[model samples]
Target: MKSSESTNTGLVVGKFWPPHRGHQLLLETAAAQVAELVVLVYANPAGPGPAADRLPAATRAQWIRELYRGDELAQGPRIGTTPLRVFALSAEGDGVPPDAAPDDVHREFVRQWLARQGIAVATVFSSEAYGPGFAQHLGAAHVSVDAARRHVPVSGTLVRKNPLATAAYLHPLVAAQLGVVPPAAIPRVVLLGAESSGKSTLCAALAEACHTAWVPEYGRTLHEQKNGNLAYEDLLYIARRHAELEDEAAHKARKVLFCDTNAATTALYSYYYFHRCDPALQAMAAVCGQRYAHTFVCAPTVPFEQDGWRGPEALRSFQHGMILMQLDFYRIPYVLVEGSVAERVAQVRRALGMVDDA
Candidate 1:
């Protein structure tokens, strides 16, 4: 069932909207058998909405290249550096069956594209039920790694459905590919507050005034994507991931990173809503306190908007107090940002010791 001994190039095809562990396992297994691997990322612009939800084809290709750019593939006489080839395939008018099943049409189109590139595809790797038949039709061998029977065969659907439960199944490499790396150096100045506290607006102005980079809040974007029904756990996950990403971005910047919020905010938010905090959330808060050089608490000023995903203004006010209390308990240095937008931005620039004209 597993090819542990073989030396031939292979082709693996998938939508890989957001490549997960199952996909990575199949790719690694196939790479073991193949002398080289060509990963064909298929995108049908005219297909249903599900295909559109995947990361853009260009972004997916970048993640794949970053994942395998310097990785060593094989060992021994059969040992050689495994080179990963990422290709973007468009099936607009390639003479392929238009009404065929999406997967089938995609596989056939990919085969034709590869042939035109002068590259012979010996095998196709996948674990889906339809993969074997599709591979056979293309005259390429089929390699399927039955991860379904494994303990952690988490699917993209399952993760999208309940991302919190499957966070443990995420591989570091995949996380990095997804732009979720912990920063090598921590930002000295961090923002901590509840939703609708004008944290993002203030952070942006501060970053501009100080000539530093700002890590935009990812939760709001996720909220908009989910139409405001995102669970509290998803918010927590996004908060944690945001901190990791902020650190990564700040590591390369010359000045402090003006982050919108940190994991502590998530811990408080989850506890407020669920009546308890997840242990992982508590640990993350502890790590955050030690990671940041300074922390700023944004006071809830403007009336909260009941965006599809947001609660009422009264609830936001309560959450703001809870967040401040949590910050106090953690002993993190803090300043409160308040007043009009201009005043808040001015205060932030002053706190960070940046010279401003007005």
Candidate 2:
């Protein structure tokens, strides 16, 4: 806010609850015309949005970064050109009335906010009727992009109502955060198996081959960090955190997500160790049957590498059988993928309706 920005810099403000293609168009159109662009993200004026609908300001910044930079976004130092600057200010009831108010009132509110930041923006870009007045209040020129929505034909309200149905309008980042991963957009593919069944390896290979991304076993990371000293409550945390991780990874994966594990596996481990699992975890585990597009079990045919955390070498077969029994008990159908990592990857490709290179 208090830096050495030039006078030719531009400004764009919104409550980007979830960024859609329309929003992307506005930003891109504005960015191309300015030396630098400042995107100010604010909370809903009615009040803070529901937890599920909230998109953090920092995350919006990252979206813009990814939008403009692509694979070169985070690469070390750039040789030429300035980059976009993002700021999130959620000051509710700080004298700025709700967006439903007249343009004059909202304009003054934005002017004061920018004044506080020591920014004298040259041009204000928007896709709404208030763009001219809003810019005038800040003593800047106004550039309205597509005020009619003919170009993108999407809106925040339309997206918020039924995000999954409008998944195509949303950016990958927004869709993933809103849990709008429709099958045509992004499919959640879960891999299940007992310990040392090559589940993790298969997940990585499939992700790489499919040119997508995968979610690793969060519980395994915790186990290693805790040195295999997980307690009862940890199971519930693992189940919830694993689901969150899957949603987070969806933004990175466009085609399909090869998940290393799911809440069902967590509940099974909890019941195995404590003789019972949390009801909350059990409920979440039940959702796994319908949550995933495809379920593949990495067969324990290969040698069981004895990891320090695995309970015992003999428990592998028993645990493997138990997993199959649980799947049958719940009437959840799954494919039993066996053999080397490449062969398993090929099986997954076939399941995904992709050509198997192997």
Candidate 3:
């Protein structure tokens, strides 16, 4: 039966620790049967048991919202007209019954919680065999979807063991959060150096050689746009937009993405000019090291070019030193690239374990 007890809403509940397409199938199926659906995600914020492996409750809830209610899963185009309400029910410190508790006990626990929340439901949707019994306990109809997993052919264990291998069965948002790089996930190779250290030239050449995509320094473009007159606040905007540009290029990237510079380098310049750094920009710089698959520090060994907006050759050297210091402070590993653009390209290729022309 698709639905019953039209006066009451429908309910679907699960840990949704690492939700897969199977969960989506259940949700869509449930929504089809009711005027409204409420998904209650459960997880233990503090645990030493099976729930310890579960993603945080808030995180799981966010994943559900992102999949069904946000962006790509935006309203009106989905399977059902029923609005879905999603929230996390903390298993810890909430008097919720343990998973091992008897069915009667667990059902009572859910009943009390629902009563407290003032939520009434007539249908309990699930993929598990417990659906019918659970629903009967709540005086609701049981609408089971794919109990054999025939439609989805995937499980939480299978998805967790090898997320990358089973990405097709998982949403892009879930795969990303679980650290499973999407097929379209481009490896970002970030180059850090002083101005006129050949980062831009090398970035373009490497992208061409690899037949991929490259992101030019947005910071420099923004600097020029502001006529080289920047304030402390401008640094945050530059760092943010620079990252956004890189992300935009990543979608069209063939195998990898080459970035001329990163947010940390932006922070260096920010501190250099204004002696201050916005907290948000600082946070971006702090995690910037982890964002790149490879880091290349362009050496100032090549003669510095005299761009109209550039500082003296001495300033270039000082900035190079500062960049290196920042890398060491953050313990970010990087390969040093010097000489002509072609030579640097070859060096990068060698770092990637490809044959390079020395």
Candidate 1 lDDT tens digits, 45-125: 522345354455555655455444321122211113566777755555444344345766666666777788888878888
Any runs in candidate 2 off by more than 4 Å, and if so which?
1-7, 43-82, 91-94, 183-292, 299-336, 340-358
Error of 1 at 340 (Å): 1.5
Candidate 3 scores a C-alpha RMSD against the true structure in Å of 8.4
Q: Tell me the number of clashing residue pairs for each predicted model.
A: 2, 0, 0
Top candidate by TM-score: 2
Positional deviation of residue 244's Cα in model 2 after best superposition, in angstroms? 17
lDDT of 3 by residue, 1-358 (tens): 4455545588888877678889999998887778788887774342234535545666676657645532222352233456778877766557666767787887787877888889888889999988899899888888889999999998877876777788767654465455553353668899888888998889889888888889999878877877887767667666666766776899888777899898888888888898987654666777666678889999988887897999998898889899999999989999999888999999998897655432
| Candidate with more favorable, higher lDDT: 1 or 3 | 3
Q: Show pairs that collide, candidate 2.
A: none
lDDT of 1: 0.65
Q: What is the TM-score of each candidate against the true structure?
A: 0.49, 0.56, 0.53
Reference-based lDDT, each prediction: 0.65, 0.74, 0.76
Cα lDDT tens digits, model 2, 1-358, are: 2234544888888877667889888887776677778887765452235653334554555445444442232442111254577776654434546657777777787788778888879999999887888888888999999999999998888887887778778644346556554343378889999899999988888888888889999989887877787778677667666766787888888678789998788889999889998655665666576678889998988788887778776888888998888888767899999989999988878877987542
Model 1: residues >4 Å from true position, as ranges? 1-186, 232-236, 356-358
